[model samples]
Target: MKRKSTLSRSTTETEISLSLNLDGSGIAQINTGVGFFDHMLTLFTKHGKFDLTIDAHGDEADNHHAIEDIGILLGKAFYDALGDKAGINRYAFQFTPMDEALCRTCVDISGRSYLVFDVPLTREFIGDFETEMLEEFFIAFTSNSKMTLHVASLYGKNNHHIVEGIFKSLGRTLKDACSIAAGNTEIPSTKGIIE
Candidate 1:
């Protein structure tokens, strides 16, 4: 069965729709009124080899609601696409380097929500996207998806490179965690189930 999901959300804060295909050829169509975010998501999709499309509209004065809502929807999409978590690797890690930046991302689809982010921020904003909002996004993602994610920046001077590396590494880590494990089709957990 092909793993895919489409989801939408509408509220006073934001309105957004997203489609995700876990098995795809790295195609992304994203618009959130945040240029840097769009670029990051494109890179993430390409690196993860997933097809994703998103259209979001939020308060023009701020990007908080938009980014947070996107995170929620994206996490729900992943959870829906995984659907039982059978045969998946369930755990993965990656270290990505972009120029002088080195970032590490590790993930576990353990049906438990947790996040540990320690990426060093060099500035307050990378373009219109607030660097501080990255944590908020990941927190929502882990909570909604019921997963554990740990991201850290070992070292980086440039904020762009650091953030970019984090996104890229996270994409790769998730791709590995979500992939089927060898020829095993049983639940990846020892308890005979996940969550």
Candidate 2:
């Protein structure tokens, strides 16, 4: 069973298309206009070992629209790809350290959307990307995907390292949550359904 999703949105401001695969080798082609943000998304897909292709064009005057919309589309794609959530692990957590930075992420595909982000950056910007936008992206993702996601930086002084650690941990945690468990055919819930 191959799960794939394509999403497109157009307004007076921007137009975007995103395609995603729940199970795939680490391959990504992303163009979101913002170089740093695109790089981050690439790292996300590669670390998660998921195939992702995004083609986005937004108001060049404003990067916020494209960035936020991409998060929205990606979250919806995940929600669509999981389908009934049968035979899946449904919950995962990971702690990863990069250099002196340590970050942890926990996720639950519980059909309920919630986000708890505890990353505090010493700098206001990582390249051209604002540190605060990371929270915006996570909120967009969790709200659309209907999943509970918590990311915390246990220790980190460098802003770049802290954010990188968080993204990598999130990718690994998502990978585990979306994986199919052998010998388990039922949805990973006693309620018999996940929303």
Candidate 3:
């Protein structure tokens, strides 16, 4: 079964179009106006081994709307692609290190949505992209996707490394969570249903 989805989201603040393929070779074509955010998305796709495409237009002066909306759209794409969540691992975790930064991410593809983010950046801005927006993005994603996510930066002196590690770890965890096991016809839950 091919797991893929395309989404178009438009609001008074932004317009976003995105495509995702769960089984892919980590190819990404992204243009989100915010360079740093785009870089993070690229890393996410690459590390997750997923093919992704995104085109977004939003309030350039204030990037929070665009970033958060993109997260929402991306989350919707993941949920739609997964369909009934049959035969999937449904849970995953990863720890990644970049230079002095160490980050961990855990994901559960549950029907309920929750997020616990404990990343502290050393700086406030990464090339005009406010670091605080990262949390907002993840909040939007988890809430819309109905997935539980936990992200933490264990140790990091550099802001870029910390953020990059988190994104990369998130990608890897999602990849594992979404993978289907051989001969596993049932959902990976004891309750017999996921969401």
Candidate 4:
């Protein structure tokens, strides 16, 4: 069975529709009115080897609601796609580098929501995307997806490179964590029930 999901969310600030195919070749169609964010999401799909589509409209004046809503909807789609998480590897870690930036990402589909983001993005904005909103986006995603995620930029001088590395590493981590392990029919937990 293919693991796929589609989700839509509408609010006073934003409206978003997202689809995800966990087992797929990397292909993405994303539009969020934020150019940098679009680039990041595209890389996320490409690096993770997941097919993804996102269409979002929001209060362009602020740009925060749009990105945050996209994160929420995308997280919901991932949760829906995984279903019971049977036979999943369930944990993965990755490090990705871009120029002088090296970022690490770790994921645990443990049915618990947690995020530890230590990316030292001191700038206020990277192009049109707010640097602070990176944390906000991940917070929304991890909470909605019920997954524990850790993202840290070990060191980087360029904010853009740092953020890009973080996203790409996260994509790789998720791709590995969500894979179905061979000959495994049980949940990846000692409690026998995940979530």
Rank candidates, lDDT, best first.
Answer: 1, 3, 4, 2
What is the per-residue lDDT of model 4 for residues 1-195, given as tens digits with 9 covering 90 to 100?
A: 679998899888998888899998999999998999999999999999999999999975688899888888888999999998999999999989999999999999999999998988889999999988999999999999999999999999999999999889988999999999778878899999887
Candidate 2 structure quality by residue, lDDT tens digits, 36-133: 88888888888898899998898867677787888898999999999999998999999999899999999999999999999887787788887788
Instruction: Assess candidate 3 and give its TM-score to the true structure.
Output: 0.97
TM-score of each candidate? 0.98, 0.96, 0.97, 0.98
Angstrom error at residue 11, model 4: 0.9
Candidate 3 residue 144 C-alpha distance from true site, Å: 1.0
Every model's Cα RMSD, please? Answer: 0.9, 1.1, 0.9, 0.9
Identify the runs in model 1 with alpha carbons over 4 angstroms from their true place: none
- Model 1 over residues 60-172: C-alpha lDDT tens digits? 76899999999999999999999988999999999999999899999999999999999879698999999888999999999999999999999989999999999999889
Q: Which stretches of candidate 4 lie over 4 Å from their true place?
A: none
Weakest 10 consecutive residues, lDDT, candidate 2?
Answer: 59-68
Candidate no. 2 TM-score: 0.96
For every model in order, what is the number of clashing pairs?
Answer: 0, 0, 0, 0
* lDDT accuracy of residue 23 in candidate 2: 92
Candidate 3: misplaced stretches above 4 Å? none
